[model samples]
Target: MIAKEFTNYIFKNNIIRFGEFRLKSGRLSPYFFNFGAFNSASKLSSLGEFYASTIIEKKIDFDVIFGPAYKGIPIALSTALSLNKKDYPDVPFSFNRKEIKQYGEGGQIIGSKIKGKRVLAVDDVLTSGKTIRNTKEIIESEGGILYAFLVALDREEKGLNTELSALEEAARECNVKIYSVANISNIIEYLNENYDKNHKFNKSVREYIEIHGSKK
Candidate 1:
């Protein structure tokens, strides 16, 4: 399956590591997904292909791809390139700047103009959902309709207050659907199937999800 393959790829590349890690939300997680590990050209190209395949598999429709500042910039560009290779030639991607450029083009947004277009925001993961909401606001302010969101992984954990997962809450609050290439469950399952069935880390991950995971 694609999810299994994607999980395997991340594991092989050491993007996902099993350990006790403090998340941005201050919760101690049993594992970590470091998207930044996909730094090399080949790794980034493969990551882009995975994201593009997910977008196509989900039938996500959008006139432009929007990536948030920093980490999202390369993802947006690579996804567009991968889509182009997958028969989606002419795919346009846009990204925002942390600070308004005062020279040259002098704009907050770079690449395609999102105004009056169906925009899909792509990112690495959904944690607090704050970033995705902020992206939505930027899109709306620019006259763009946020059609949906795409992420590499869904942690499947509850929001700060709600019983809904972060992804679910973001989709509800933003009024846009969110899709992921894989979720925590897929990773755990892949590990159990491919690695030792009684691995201590796998057991810990299962317990962690039991305590914090959202209802399917």
Candidate 2:
């Protein structure tokens, strides 16, 4: 159970909160995952270990790890470091700049070159899959193939079309495998079995999922 452990870790750290929150899609959600809560060094290292473990467990093959600009930068770096320490050495990581550098090594990408490489994009969560699509475009534009995507959690909610979950849609549309360390289903199961079953937040989360969860 790495997934269970991760679920507990996120709950203990308050990285995943149960309450009313508005999403970018303008939907009211009962639960929210704040990846930015991993602010401390130890927390970030643990987060990286979770991602690295998932990548290793899944046997994902890639030449480089690419994190999208901003939030994904540290995730990519940390995962690479954790992998190296866990004996998956020399896994190069790269990230894009929000603004292209006009001088010197002038490009949007920083760190390892992605040209002709197989890239694994790392991010926090899968909501609408817009971020994943954008990252795929960036990798393709730079002559790299996006091998797969890894995220901390998969919301498992309906996509824009209200048919498939965002994760499922992203994988199908991008033609790449997408993996998560844990997902909303895992969280629900963990709460029902390990946490207080009578908790109001637990009830609320379960109800919300019943309404919003994807069909498959």
Off by over 4 Å in 1: none
The CA lDDT of each predicted structure is 0.89, 0.90
Displacement of the residue 185 alpha carbon in candidate 2, Å: 0.9
For candidate 1, the per-residue lDDT at 36 reads 76
RMSD of each: 1.2, 1.2
| lDDT digits (tens) for residues 1-216 of candidate 2 | 878889989988999987799998788998899887999999999989999999998898999999998889999999999999998868999999988899998999999999999999999988889999999999999999999999899899998676899888889889998998999988998789866867888888888888888999
lDDT of 1 at 207: 89
Residue 23, candidate 2: C-alpha displacement in angstroms: 1.1
Backbone clashes in candidate 2 total: 0
* lDDT of candidate 1 over 17-80, digit per residue (tens): 8889998878899899998799899999998999899988889999999999888899999999
lDDT of 1 at 210: 87
